[model samples]
Target: MAMGRAHVSTDRPVAGRFRPVEITHRETNRVRWYADDLRTGRPFLVTRIGLPPDAGDAVRRAPSRVLRTAGIVSRLCPERTATVVETAVEGGFLWIVTAWIDGTPLDDVLAGEGAFDPVRAARTGLDLLDVLDAAHAGGLTHGELSPGEVFLRPGGPLVVAGYGLTGTTPAPRLTAPSYAAPEQARGEPAGPAADLWALGAILYALCEGRAPFRDRGRFEATLRGVDRLPLRAPVRAGPLTPVVQGLLCKEARERPTGAAVREALARVVREDTGVAPTAGPDTRPRGGHSPALLCAGREVSRRAVVLGAVPAAAGVAALVLAATRGLSGTATGTSSGPPPASASGPTGSGPPDSGRDEPEPGGRGAAPAPTGPPGSAGLPPGYRTLHAPEGFSVALPAGWQRLDTSGVSGLAYRVTFGADDDPRRLAVTYSERVGTDAVAVWRDDVEPLLRRSGGYRRIGGIRATTYRGREAADMEWFTAADGTRVRTFGRGFLLGGGRGFSLRWTTPADGWAEPGSREALRTFLRTFRP
Candidate 1:
């Protein structure tokens, strides 16, 4: 196994073709090996083929006469990556194998690079859609689809790897917080539509450069983030706003097919942009450009930025989008690290590193330290949490994630933070709820709130926009709160009557902590029942 400094390891692939179809029931699905390793080539484990009780029998019987009976459906794999090796009866198991993919999975790509550019992201998405459609034609279900199953070839196009794998092999529970389809989490068998939702998530990440949902919560929360949340994309992610939202719909049936998704994305390029898609694997266009631009299908916008130089067609598309719609907010980076971090915690907030809990009191386990006081244990003694004179009380993090108090006599609060992602981002914003129309209310309220928010920080116009449907404002400026040095983009939305309810999603700059604490901030937001 090749182990890297990052603690990840892998085996060097050898050229051969045999694979282990890890089915659920060895008794019924077991493929009595007619040949050993020598004759079998290389072995591949089908991560999943079916659910617990039935997978083994299904897999074992697949090689029997099922394939012939099922017949060949759609062949979605691109020619370069794989050609149908013909539905084969290997040993006693039936399976589908393209060329072996020996590259990093797309899941890692997202974790490493906050998200991907829209063009490339869309291309990969549609490619998978075609594959799924092909399989659907065969009456087979993908069962599971996530970024982890996607593999981005160095020089080749992105290819999905796990097929028939998830159905058989037992899938471990997903613990990390990231975008996932609603059905997959519930243990319900996933179908073609599920795959489309997965594709939309990948596209969202590519355009927005971050998982649609934060991992702060568990399975249900993740489902909500993917299925329920309508928060806008970050300001800089302007081009892809509609795209991500469109893809994140709760109902999978609502999402279009790979062809439709490709067509819609292409339309974004043509209508919003007006250029051909970037070159394919061979850098050639299949046809001039697919001209089926019927986007009444989705209401959200989507975007893909070319990290390097994009195809000439992409530029034309971007120009069209800019002319018709509008290019998103622009942010230039100093060095490209995490977004700026807030230096101070809440006043009387515990020591800056208070949250960085040391060994617990006893060798027993990690114990929570008293942040500040009992009532303000998470908060500081004299300092306040994010409280509105409107009878709202939530436990805000003491130090890193603080409320912006620079408004008129402390009428409002601003918190700034960063996230480690590509196109590096910073979120800074003023907070309050003035009216019904979220956007309009935020527009008219922040200035006056600032007046009530007492402070000496220079007041200037905020030059940012909302993310999702949350009312927010932002600006790229040196934070006057904690002078650790960095560009900042802030946002927050107050719901309910009289700013009694509010929620915030801050992307802090790297290295910098929150105005208070991240967890505390989360608790404060979670406290909101709505």
Candidate 2:
């Protein structure tokens, strides 16, 4: 189980972002339990219980909109060391929790800490583009970055934790699968340059802690050398390593905005606070107050950290400073808000198609996308689109071909409708951040290189039909040198960490010994959410 943990004397839920408690009722209308979240000790899921006395003033305006989305995610990285809270559990459930962060997430600390330190991992990739330039300029889009949502917490009481922002809103549920991208991991609609290609695979895992491409064994053909690789200056002290090789360019409009990635991480926090050498760009001293003002409204700290700028409507009073504590985007560059052009690109694409044309830095047309809003992209979200992450719910499987494309409003494609000769062996996938359960991935670095190919193995199966708000597990696995052992399944839903996630799948059941592999792994984990 490699480094795979789960027993420092168990507290439970601490596997991947530390899982804790999440005991939702029999779809008894979600909620009824969301008791704790003081930085992920875990609990919060009042996914809107029974409605009427007329939706009780919309569940009293949802714990103040999940504490104003954790006070606008702590004023967008006010020096990253999280803490967002909002709980109203048991029956009329509702929750919003944060703070179980502590270093090691540049995709699992660059797999083994190789090439980064480059100015402190280029100022932690410009403090994740200054909190994704205040959550896509107040629209939010951490679609699901990786390295388990890039954390790094070095020194005692330090910071840098973004653990998947409760599945971001307006419509989001494509958790970071190996820093996602290839058209949002073949599902789609992941903006903010797919969080700049998971921040250039965390600057290729800071020069090599563990990223260069995935699915191993030939590693997806080395991503054509990461879509035509070419980067140099790599030694360490990660202060924006030449702007994280220019925001790890694989095209998303050549990369840089979110206030130029927080002004290239405030010039590497003014050379890690020695604060002297000045002639070209920033040396500090713009006095309102400085001496590394520890965390308060956040000015800088975390080995010279200093990202500030959060007001895309900062709510829940930014969680009273985390007891307290804390923590952008664009193609290569362009900030000052207003750009995601309403989730740009796909439906009836091209004849004037546009994701606002950004790419060019690394050329080769770098992943052109956006396929919605214009002609309604591929349609869905029409009926005034409200789905919000309140509690959460989803379930797909019926004949399986529901696409509704164009800039996907929160996710769910459902294919396996493949025919033209029984070719669709068994592909039952599901997507739903129905409210945010926070997915932490890098899938154990692509499951040990996809189990070194000779036919993978990450199994578990038999038994099913257990439903309600949901919390399930079942399996039947295979990858058989080529047999692709059919009926497989995996489930661990709790989608309320922020919005929803913990989804799982696998289907190719010709064998795997008997009982249609337990009703096709219980119809792929019972069609999922409700």
Candidate 3:
């Protein structure tokens, strides 16, 4: 059995810094305190896990392993992961300090709110899957996941805590025996599959108001039940019944893969939100052009020629292409004639007829650009400025390389940048066949197609704008990409004479407002030179 830390006076500080103010939560082998840092005068949560006296090597390595794993996960998901500020091990106890989480623990929520509806539970399950996907991709397993470790903020996604606890103790199922996988109960090493079992338990608890395997009043007895007893069918799981049953399978090998689970959860979200799934495969090319290009003297509709000339202007086509091949393509407009030397020179026509009033150049009511310190001034560390041969420059984070480029013979070209495995990307496209009204292009040509995407939600009305003194328009919207919700911000403007440039930035929808994401967006907008 794990030893428990002895009670200390409230006035006394731990590790000469954290002063325990009150006990916030307690579990079988762990306890959490609402504490204050005496040195910094900041409030933080302090979690102390009791270690057996004979823990030996596990005890010696617990602090470092916990801190290192926490650091890795924090970087991958800054918004949804708890940031561990400090860790310490002394006298049979391992302590972890983290910033104050402005949310209610899942344990508390279940205790107070009872069983959740299928839709809400599915939303929470999707968030968990996303975190797990990133962690597993990075070669990490959160073996200690439980309802107690998940925090739910009002109007925000869940934030996960208690990473790096899988290997900290010698005994299997040390903290939550009822939630542990059958493999772990049998003394086998826990892995990603074990985490899925815990996720299943959490989902079961959310839908039924109790864990699938109820505790038998003792750790050994509960673990034995987990290893041998059959899972009770969930009565209130509704549409989530199959997923819960699949994940809780006693044989880890029989459980659903992460990708499968993600797809299932995405389907649930779509159903609940009334968003129909895509009807068929998206065969559109990345550049949005048809398979056969138009030849001289060939009869073609004006719209078809314009669309084929610059595939990027086909916004719906671009969305479909992004879904098929990751979001890593450029968008550009093209003229009827052959390619030109400079696509960014000038385009004198207004946007295609969309029945909307076109704003005059330097017009009033132009959407104001985001204000901040200029030109990468507020960029996060590790980003450097990139000067493109195409006469534009922007700052990008380290590890972002040019992923791909597309163009029409000579009239237009687009360059995309990011690591191959990265989910986010930036696309810069220049074209000689631009419409005069940026707002009309987005409203009339772009949005009609974007609406066809699942869960497509326009964040705001298209706004005529100016970028670097040129006529521009800004459009923001949310859509799903490969089962992950994604948000995109596009700004397209004309230099003059039917020539223009467009910049589009995309990131996971759940992380759009994270500090790092905000910094990146701000930097891209402030520094890009057309």
Best by lDDT: 3
Tens-digit lDDT track of model 2 for 356-429:
23311111111111101112111112211112142222322233332221112435322222223322232222
Model 1 C-alpha lDDT per residue in residues 165-205, reported as the tens digit of each score: 33443332222225456666555566766666666666766
Better of 2 and 3 by lDDT: 3
Global fold similarity of model 3 (TM-score): 0.52
Where in model 3 is the C-alpha error above 4 Å?
Answer: 1-11, 276-530
Judged by whole-model lDDT over C-alpha atoms, candidate 1 comes out at: 0.34
What do the candidate models score in CA lDDT, each in turn?
A: 0.34, 0.33, 0.61
Considering lDDT, where higher is better, how would the candidates rank from best to worst? Answer: 3, 1, 2
List TM-score per model, in order.
Answer: 0.37, 0.23, 0.52
Model 2, which residues run further than 4 Å from truth? Answer: 1-62, 67-115, 130-132, 135-261, 265-530
RMSD of each: 18.9, 24.0, 20.8
Cα lDDT tens digits, model 3, 257-340, are: 876776676577678777632221111233332212211111222223222212211111111111101112223111000000
